[model samples]
Target: MWIKKFTIRGILVGLVCVFFLSPVCMAELPITSSFGWRVHPITGAWKFHSGLDLGYDYGTPIPAMFDGVVVQAGDFGDGYGNQVMLYHPAMDCYTRYAHMSGVIVDVGASVAQGEIIGYVGATGNATGPHLHLEWIVKGEDGGYVYADPIGLWM
Candidate 1:
């Protein structure tokens, strides 16, 4: 009887740890592809990937990693379909969410961290459904530089 009680307690503790310690609880975004140089899946040409790809099921709600205002939210009509761009004033940076099937926010809307702003999908020059996330910071030359979203944000 003592062994059974111990096992049950251990299982319960493990469940609590997993529930509270998981990414879902940690507010971490799910990433499918990383940023950097890689051979394109369709083009097969080596190039610098400007963003990290986070995937969810088709039409899954995408959360914002930080509080920001929506600057651009719509289709690029080419490489980035149904995208949402947010400008973070505190960070002095811009975050882009590309290749979305659907977007829920509009320009000038304020979004809180972990708030749903769009849905995941394979739009634009993508092979499957995923959120192409990009971090943009001001360059020394006044232009914007793209960075990997992995570890940098979530």
Candidate 2:
């Protein structure tokens, strides 16, 4: 009977540890910065703003959100202007940065988290100088879906 109780207690303790550690393992964004806020700039009115606007002076350096290979980097010409797409296999995610004044990384290049990848600016459809960052999870059908950037930061 004592051995049975000890085994049950061990299992309970293991379950508790797994429950607490799962989130930490899945949570992304190991770095913190003075980015992200709730404000609407596109509509010129207060709306549920998504993503972060890393406001720095024009030509301020922008960094990679994670270690990834630069899959696309150039003028997309569809209101994204100078854009870059990084593919992170570990996270199974892709990060896009739009409206860059200059793109520093080239296609097929590997970049580390927090490494400068470009410069923020008012390009394409932007009304002011800022970076429009987006995180996307690739769907099974080769389509990409948007994910909340704040969730990654948490």
Question: Highest lDDT among the candidates is held by which one?
Answer: 1
Best by TM-score: 1
Q: Identify the runs in model 2 with alpha carbons over 4 angstroms from their true place.
A: 1-51, 138-143
Candidate 1 pairs with clashing backbones: none
Stretches of candidate 1 exceeding 4 Å from the true structure: 1-21, 24-31, 140-142
All models: lDDT?
A: 0.71, 0.63
Candidate 2 lDDT by residue in tens digits, 22-72? 333323323222233434446565443333444456787787766799999
lDDT of 1 by residue, 1-154 (tens): 0000000112123212332244342144466666787898879999777887766679877777578999999986768888999998986878888898889998999998777898889988899998787778766566667755554423
Pairing residues by index, what is the TM-score of model 2? 0.64
